[model samples]
Target: MRADIHIDSDLLQQCRKGSSKAFRELVEQLKRPAYYHALSLTGHSDDAMDVSQEAFARAWQNMSSYNPSQPFYPWYYTILRRVALNHLRSRSRRREDIDNGQIDTMLTEAGGPGEDCQSVQYSNLVQQALMHLSIEDREILCLKDMHDHSYRELADIVGVPIGTVMSRLYAARQRFRQLMKESGYEHE
Candidate 1:
């Protein structure tokens, strides 16, 4: 998620200087978003956890490459995305796990309390539709829509130009809308 939390420059400097304590603090701050973002890409809790942890390890190993002035998540996201994508690639197939139970839990968390049956069903449909999308399409959609990343953040996180981010988000939205319609979910 695009949390407004900023990594303290001091903390980052210490991390760069090989302080495991500082890096642990960084992990405490970012671990939730890291897992959730990885989950969005990997579609399984176990895989997401593994991928995010691996990304964090990689981030620590490559600490010198990080620009302390920039937001940590975006930089960390690059590692997380790479790790997640590699995991996805190694799996050799997109599993149908999203439809099973995780999507329901995610929807419940996103929806908060008092969601009706209709809302749950709609969320299920949306998740199902998302599963049908290409990984690129799904990643862009989740990064923008689910995680609240801005266009510039999207470009930075996805390693694309702002124009490419806009175009991809637009195209991904169109395809998602079509998928929703096919799943019998109509929206204005």
Candidate 2:
């Protein structure tokens, strides 16, 4: 784990000791990441803003429940995911289109200037396929593939064993591939 990625243990201890500055500093450090994660998971800008803020509030209100010795994000993630998923469950009956026409950016460099129409179309198809995935699958894919988090980091943030992260990633990718095939995207 990078020393910079986690807020210092001492900082967490200070928060535990009821240091308001430490708490604010912790929230400042985490706010953007938590918001982005919520945004990706919820696929709705407003919901992301709401859920992430709520997660922070809940986490702060229950700070005593957090263990100071461990990495903060993992504990925070539990709160964030619960809130985000609950939001999803409430909206499950009304399915919104997942940003149609947003191209899969991974294809950008791969396609290059020389690769034109077909590549662009393929990228769109892949993105559409991605949109069809379950929120948990999408979150796992984002953490592992998009953000390039290693298995251990994924395990920490996801509150899963490293082995489970690997297995889940494999399953998510497999389902992604299936979706692509269903969407008329043939792997090149």
Candidate 3:
């Protein structure tokens, strides 16, 4: 997820001076994207909530290191990504409870799974197909498609050149299309 708004310089200065209100404001602007971004990586609501909060705590602790001249999210994203990756690493050791029911709810909402069983089945297949993607692929698709980020924002958040972002997006979509085909989801 990307925020088009730049961080207020005054807010940064105040935060640097230990102003709690300024810090809270900054968190308010970011916390939703941060949580959704973490959710994209972690694939579990609980893990996303925990890791996102932890990343914010770390961001506050390391506030002095931030360059006020730069866009805040790219730097903040580094911290969030590190924390999320570490969580993924540790959690890989354990059996993750795949919450398919929760996923069904999400798909139903997005696909508007109505009276039609076919659409529900399609949504489920799409959800399962997403699980087969690499975390990077899934993250890019969600950040760009679901979160409505521009290519420039995508480049910044993903830390890649615009061309690479374009190429990766193409490849990810192509792979997803293949998955859908293989899963028997015909185009409407």
- Best model number under TM-score: 1
What overall lDDT goes with each candidate model?
0.83, 0.78, 0.79
Expressed as tens digits, the lDDT of each residue in 9-102 for candidate 3 is: 8988888788888999999988888877787777677888899999989988989998888888888888988999999888773333555444
Provide the clashing-pair count of each candidate structure: 0, 0, 0
- Candidate 1 C-alpha lDDT tens digits along 97-154: 3434564555467676787889888887888887788878988988888879888888
lDDT of 3: 0.79
| Cα error, candidate 2, residue 71 (Å) | 1.2
* Model 1: CA > 4 A from native: 94-99, 110-114
Q: TM-scores of all models?
A: 0.89, 0.82, 0.86
Query: Between 1 and 3, whose TM-score is larger?
Result: 1
Clashing residue pairs, backbone N/CA/C < 3 A, model 3: none
Candidate 1 vs 3: which has more lDDT:
1
- Residue 58 accuracy (lDDT) in model 3: 93
The sequence of per-residue lDDT tens digits that candidate 2 reaches over residues 1-188 is 12134788888888888888998999888877777677667766677889999998898888899987688888998899999999888776444555544324333545566778876877777667666788879889877776677899889999899999999999999999999888777777
* Candidate 1 overall lDDT versus native: 0.83
